[model samples]
Target: MSDSAPTEHVLLTPGPTPLHPRAVAALLRPMLGHMDPEVFAINDEIQADLRTMYGTAPDTFTALLSGTGSLGMEAGFANLVESGDEVLVCVNGSFGARMAEMAERYGARVRVVTAPHGQAVRVEDVAAQLSGVQMVAVVHGETSTGVLNPVPEIAQLLRGTDTLLTVDAVTTAGMQPFDMQGWGVDYAYTGAQKCLSAPPGVAPVAISERALARFAARRTPTPLWYCDFEGLRDYWSRRAYHHTVPVNLHFAFHAALRAALDEGMTVRQRRVREMGAAIQTALAPLGFSPYVQREAERLPTVLALRLPEGFDDAGIRAALRRREISVTGGLGPTAGLIWRLGLMGEAARPAPYRALMTALEDLLGERGVAARFDEALAGVPV
Candidate 1:
């Protein structure tokens, strides 16, 4: 590979995070037929690991899809939502809104309960919304604004109701503690690229028997043939072909799951928490306050910080790129007002954390903005 061949840059944004070295090699492994016994063994290992990571025992049904997280989202909705079904979507970020749109596209009667972009969706509000709803959907970790929703409480609220609970754990899966069975989360999905430290293109989905039964009894066929859960489940379970699985991406996911197990979920969660604390501490004295008020409510892997009074967000982002650092600008309501910093998987290490802080300080200082570089770095605990 030529060094100047537009060298792939390190991704510091939330999803499709920086990949582990071993995961890269796994992706390069020779591909096998999806129906091969060896490949099926690999799939079995991946499913078992997913069960462990999700903290669910007998109640979980796991499947790997040949697309990104959004595909899993569609799968979950398309299977449960038929025409005239009532769906309540809790919207606090971009992903939640996407869920609502998907439900509507499936011909369900969709009701949206929205909160401010950086705020959590209140469980009480969701409970009220669930009065006549068949399903309730939320984003467990809203990557758009770095807010972690109260999924446990929300799940508890919907326990005995007819409303099924579905969560989008794309950014939270490997970096936090998620008990799907314990919390009664009927359906959930995650992408392989975020905290899994794998390349993009595969999504892992978990469905409870309750959700599966709902799919079996759907009155109308799902609008999308490709994402129909019943058909896909037949293929994935019997090793029959509904569509070609992305064989190389499965290799990458297998290696990524091994890395996650090696690190242990507790250790990985601690590392993510420590990195978030360090970044928050380092930026405080430099006049960069977090957009979210309560630190505990924020997702550890992604941080949204307010930009300096006069600094342009896009300009600062461009400056960071010039220095070989990649940070994202906010989306929707936060656009141009905040910068999103992601510390996920391999990219969540101390080296990248320190580098980002130092680079930001230098850029600000050179632009004639006053900042205490030494004090900021010193404030970061060892």
Candidate 2:
């Protein structure tokens, strides 16, 4: 017997995944005044939860910037970098390359240590680029290519250096293990819409003591008015007048954080990891292969697939969409060569995965590839 059709479209894209019911409910609530005591209380709770999620000390500075993850990235660079300062960027995917570009635009003498698409950047490569660099930036999870860079190793390599290490954990924040303090990451950023299961709008950023020190010691002010770290921090605290805080998004973000904590970080990470392993095992028999060669380097939430020869990338994705399933195509170099499937937040659960896989089986069968729906699903331990 066929599974019942889902009541809503399944979101299989790398981000903006299906929201948790609590998050949706929170989003629907009426907005509060930016200065309301209740709003302040919710924001405080969100900040505390964010610190826990980032694995940082209680005293560490954390704030929700009023933009997407890219704003977080810009805030990290703009607040820390000065003109003529040397900056090194490790680029393995679109997001990594974006860091390099943003650094350059900030007037830093940017140097990029790059790897081929669908692969993680090596610690050795990043180390080689570190000399005289005032800051080093890398993306912890490269959603575009489904590769998780060796962030802890890179952090270890940069230890004791004056050069700060910044990371973009937009896709890895809740799904994978991210210990900013333990890993010695000075600055790390994540989006609300990814593993947080909230809609896009806020970027929850954590700043280390070293990062705060660097910000304090900066010779010049951060150019951007909206995302300036100091300004955001003050606004979140007693100041309360940086910008009109997105009150509804804050509610959604708070609800998502509560849901994440309720699930427990350890369990959530394991769920994503197990689902990812199941996907790999299930697809292997159907002639699909992972874009990232090493299992260790693959991102659990965003799975990049190398289609079998003669399979049309656009055609298959379009077919999936028609069936109310959504997946994304590759970006930049990997474009037209691979497909990206996201198992994130609410969508990371068994029901969504089963819906996606069963639909995929039918699509592959239509394309003349005999995919065993039951056998493939049996591989999923959910």
Candidate 3:
């Protein structure tokens, strides 16, 4: 071994979090070819785990797409939408708006129902607009503003209608409760990085049989091939080649999935939920408040905060970097206006949480906030 020590770095950014120890070890495993029969077995296992993660039916077709979450989102739209279809996209943050854009690109006549950046999408508004809509798309966790939309309630409204519900669960899958069957979600996709504590590249997706039937009956052929449900499903189910699979990422993702299951979904969700809450609650006295005002609507995995007056965004963030800690500033409309702290995966652990608290207090020179944060951290299981 090299004499040099490996410095401990904390990742509070959204994607590409530090890998879990199991994933790290899996990455060093012997490589396999895409054509290797064992590769397909691993794929089957990952798909089954994804179904468990999404709470989909056993027959729900699942696959690990060889792309990022953005591609996964695009594939989701490509499969569900057709020319002239009326797609209802509920936009509360950047990701929601991206879904609307994706729908329009796929030739859907898109209608948008928007809420303020930091608020939840109103189920009543969605209920009023369900007429003639072929599909209703929403984001489960709005990472940009840290708002958790009411997907269950929105899914409920689509129950009797022919409208299928597609959800962007990029940031919530492994760390939160994703009951696609229970919530009546027809299609859902998530990246490997965010809550899975794995490297980015693969996007795990699930499509209910209802959604597949809708794809089968599409008036127009899906314009995209790589993301088309039929081709990809054949590749996964029959080992037919549509595209070169990311075999190495598969190893790491499999390990990550097993780790998540081993920890028990309920326990992991609680850890993520409690970690974000305690950190943000303690921040109250430190001159920081959550960007999303309502507690009920806030996303626990990603915490968006309104920085105190005259807070130095650059200098402080740089200082934290010096301490080997990382967090991100806001994007788009909220840029430089808020800070997004990702209490995801291993970052949700007590050591990192405590380090963040101590660093913030040191940087802000706010002992009172430190006291309150310590008190709050004491109660958090993470």
Candidate 4:
């Protein structure tokens, strides 16, 4: 590996979005022992803040892990699901499919209920597939398609059932409204990088008492040692030193959580909605349309747009790269046909929207696609 590789400041990708200056500074702060009194205090404060951000009162058991959002998924399954247990996974995008794969890896009988790439999963469809299911897992925000699943409705449908309701809120956590308690979600996980504006190493997970009880009564040992929820809770709660916690990452997460609370969840939600609407409005005149049909079903943090006819997705991406912009290509089935744009955390602003639109217009012009940049930009709010 060469150390001289050029690096860019722009991060327009779906995840690991731009970090706030305060969060970056927190990462550079003096490290402390995981068992240090001050560090434990910070950890306790962050757990409380996570509960607030997740909109769950006393029902959630929250933890901060030293990995990405995928770790939370593994932890969720490893703790709640057991060998021969039936798990129903609702798949609409790449992340949804990952849930099924993770459950199967834990020896659970995985049944996937899939919707088309750009469509939202209907609650009725999920209920229909819930027969004999021990757990129901869904991605609240389909990051690959920018479709927001009706999590509350899905939760309500699963109410009073024996099945546990697990949700992946990686792309929607702080950027949108999620009521873990009100929605009756048993387990929910989110990455710090997306809406929280923290560095990528930490994943915040919230589990309901119901889910913890299931974990306590597991018939078999959890397949993964690192992700065992009972052990992790003992470590985080009792400070028993299960593993050396990532001290600096915890600092970054604490700073990010403070920022989120300071900004207020309502304020953050409004900013996301406004930014998303602005981008959609601006892109319409450029002949770009959103993959999601209903605005209500769209995630404010991530946007998926269809490529214009005859335009090369990779070529345009390369052109943007020369200009220091870094939008990403589609994933899985949507590859080459669509582009995923992230307006997460601090990037959910008018200035970044303007910059991206400007670069896109220039790239389209170079590719012989007629684009009216001024007209497209005029639609955005000042």
Candidate 5:
């Protein structure tokens, strides 16, 4: 081995979050063959756990794709749309735009209903543009701008129509209370690295019965074989042989999901909410406010904080990195204007937030700004 040491840091970015000790330990455990009976048992457990977390009916199909969260997005569209199908995508941030692009690539006649970067798409806006739409796509939590779209209202608007609802719940899934069945979301996909605190690679996707019906009725087979829903279902059901699954990452993901379930969804949701509010409170003294305009629409898992004027965004991030703290910069239209701070899973507790605040305090103090870290933290409830 080289004489170099590992550079350790407190991870506070959106995805590929700090892993739970249990999950880390699981990752280090011996690997299992994908076709082994024991591995299939583990897959069964994971699907059950995912179904529970997704808040979908027992009949709803939940599968783990051996790719990032975007893989699910691609599969969701590929199974639902045929050539020249009308798809209405609500774009408020980068991910929504990406979904629109993915759908268009699948031969969808995509109509974009857009909102400003920091705001969310209005249900009325989606309603106004739903003319002969085959499917409607939206992001539940737009991590790019920290905006939580109104999913329930939009689902209500799509009630009587044949249009299916597909949601990108990558940042919202394990971080907050998401009800796939209650909200009538036809398809929802999330990553393990975000709120699950597991290693990246496997994405858990939930599909509703309605979506499965649509997939069954599709005239043409999905050209993408790797992510074909029918093939995946057969593999998961043990009827057909699919590609070799990543056993190690699945181990970590299974442990992470168990941890979430053990903590209980409601309690975990409250912790993230309290922590997010704490971060906003902690940063207020430093003139770092939430970038999203509406307080009600702000995501509790990820905080997109608008940078103070005259503050060097890259410089501050670099300074934090030197101190072994990892935070992310803004994406898409919000770049150079905001900082995306994620308080998720194992990193969502008070200690991490306190450390982040203290570091910010020191960084600002060097610039002749007095950030009252103690006072700001006092507002955070224990």
Candidate 6:
């Protein structure tokens, strides 16, 4: 008997992965005023849980911005960077490049250190450009190519300096370890939809006291008031008004956080890691090699795979959609060359992996590559 990809969630994709059942249920509950006492209670829960996920001190400033992860990225720069400050960005993939662009737009004198799309950014290369920059920005997980950067090593380089280290944790927040306080990172952000299993729109961010101090001492005013660190903190931490908080998304986010904690972050991270390893091991011989060639650096939640040279990318994606399955394709440079299969949140378990492999086996048979890939995956696919 063959397992089938889940139809309920449209299977999976990198971001906006299927929501936890609790989050789904939370969405149906009655809405609350953004400033209601119950909503304040909810905000407190979200802030506390998000801090734990980010591995930050209790006093660290954390908030849920009213936008997607991209908004979180923009907030990181807009709050910390003022005109003429030098910002160095490490670009190994699309998200890194986005940081470079955001920094420039925020009026930072931006410089970039880059690696090819499929590779991880080197800590040594970042060290070379570390001098005199106001901040060194990097993406902890590059979902575009499934590579995890050396964030702790890079953060270590800025230990004693005035220069801050900012990170884009959009894709790794819940599935991988985040030691913002221990790693000495000043600013970082993640989306609700990814590993949090919440709906889209709310992006959680963590800010160290060090970064908050710098924000307070900025020479010029923050470019955006809506997501400015002080305003967001005032709203989430002090219950002061900033924007009309997405009350329902908060309900979902709170429920999702509870579910992740219920599973234990350690267990959740291990589950995602094991899933990636199993998929890579089972699929390699069948022509689905990892885009990140080095096994150690690949992202566990978003498994980016190389499509065989002659495989028709569009056709495969369409076929998967017909089966109510969803997988992301590469962006920019890697487009038409790779598949980003996300095994995240509720989908990280064996049922989803078994479903994915079954679909792949059927697709392979259709392509006449193998009548059965079950032999390759054997007992490991699930």
Q: Could you tell me which residue pairs clash in candidate 5? A: none
What are the runs in model 4 whose C-alpha is more than 4 Å off? 1-8, 366-382
Candidate 5's displacement at residue 185, Å, is: 1.0
- Candidate 2: stretches off by over 4 Å: 1-7, 366-382
Q: For every model shown, what is its TM-score relative to the native structure?
A: 0.93, 0.94, 0.95, 0.93, 0.94, 0.93
The numbered model that scores best in lDDT is 3
Instruction: Give Cα distance to truth, residue 138, candidate 1, Å.
Output: 0.5
lDDT of each: 0.83, 0.85, 0.87, 0.84, 0.86, 0.85
TM-score result, candidate 4? 0.93
**Tens digit of per-residue lDDT, candidate 2, span 135-228:** 8899988999999899999999988888799999999987779998888999999999999889899999999999889888988888987888
- What is the alpha-carbon lDDT of model 5 when measured against the actual structure? 0.86
Candidate 6 wrong stretches, greater than 4 Å: 1-7, 366-382
Per residue, candidate 5 scores C-alpha lDDT tens digits across 6-50 of 766788888778898889999998877888888788889999999
Model 2 lDDT on a 0 to 1 scale: 0.85
- Relative to the unseen true structure, what is the C-alpha lDDT of residue 330 in candidate 4, on a scale of 0 to 100? 88
Assess candidate 5 and give its TM-score to the true structure: 0.94
Backbone clash pairs in model 4 (N, Cα, C under 3 Å; residues 3+ apart or in different chains), count? 0
| Winner by TM-score | 3
Looking at candidate 1, what is the lDDT of residue 174?
A: 84
Candidate 1 TM-score, C-alpha based: 0.93
Candidate 3: where are CA atoms >4 Å away?
A: 1-3, 368-372
Q: Give the range of the ten consecutive residues with the poorest summed lDDT in model 2.
A: 366-375
Regions of model 5 farther than 4 Å from truth: 1-7, 366-382
